[model samples]
Target: LHTGCIPPIVHRDIKTTNILLDQNFQAKLADFGLSRSFPTGNETHVSTVVAGTPGYLDPEYYRTNWLTEKSDIYSFGIVLLEIITNQPIIQQSREKPHIVEWVSFMIRKGDIRNIMDPNLHQNYDIGSVWKATEIAMSCVSPSSIGRPNMSRVANDLKECLISENSRTGESRDMESKSMEFSMGIYTEVIPKAR
Candidate 1:
């Protein structure tokens, strides 16, 4: 669901595992039981009990029980990081389980070579890689307002992919086929649940 509706549908649960790939590898959103159509205009946010996957949950929503479209953006950011690192939300190791923290640390340390999937083997465009990582980082901003709207994100990601295609000399057709899937946790967080 690309969210073209009048009142945007907020996917309360967004995780990497929930996205499914079709035979053509196009991403598809699954599990819609938890979606709620967000209110628009002067209403700042919807008050509801916070419900979502642990590592993917938005800190702001968890703290204040304020649900907004930005909450879904936060989870989408985690998924982006997962794609970049080819790592699960929580790793098997005890010292560093959260991929988000690990990636942030690695980027901060300027040790990004290890952050990219080894399968990539430096074949991808460096600029595109950085652009994508930056997008993910932007999505995970602690402040919900700090995150870019979906339109901005879509543009940024499109630019990233286009740049990659140009740099790698990949076919134009391949660029059109790129897709992303979103994981959603099914839950109904009633207003009273707040």
Candidate 2:
């Protein structure tokens, strides 16, 4: 869900390519051409034509033609998965073509380590990685109602960062600054989507 507003705006398209990172690695979600806002407080969703990247589209929104903040959550979840695994969202030759399906299969096998990017060389904190994986999985839940709002995701990811920092013995000042930028990305950037 979009943050930093009472009536949150829904950015119907959210993907890794659209997420721009400045030199300092501060993230900014760009490309809001498909954004839509709930016209009234009582309305839960905006009925609109489904439009988004194939790999990142929210299945529920595509099926029902009902667009909501949860749709954005699903796309962002895919982004998270991409960040973790460094794998393409869809690989046709793979048995499980979709990234979510592949990740789920790997998780079922208890192979979290393999699911992570090989480039990491298992240098990350397992607890932190697990937490992030859980958050990403929840964001891609089949039911929109089951998915979390953006604030919760931001907070949970911040916890992951803190846990990772604790492992590496990073300074609290660095954590604070990183978290502040991260929070702005999740809370402020998406809401400004037109």
| Candidate with maximal TM-score | 2
| Model 1: lDDT of residue 139 | 97
- Checking candidate 2 for backbone clashes, the offending pairs are none
Please list the residue runs of candidate 1 whose C-alpha ends up more than 4 Å from where it truly belongs after superposition: 1-3, 92-95, 173-194
TM-score of predicted structure 2: 0.88
Q: Lowest lDDT 10-mer window, candidate 1?
A: 185-194
List TM-score per model, in order. 0.84, 0.88
Across 41-124, the per-residue lDDT of candidate 1 in tens digits comes to 677688898888899999999999998889989999999998998888888683567887788888888766688888988788
Cα lDDT listed for each candidate: 0.79, 0.85
lDDT per residue for candidate 2 within 48-131, as digits (tens), equals 888999989999999999998899999999999999999999999978999999999998898889999999999999878887
**Top model number, lDDT:** 2
lDDT of 2: 0.85
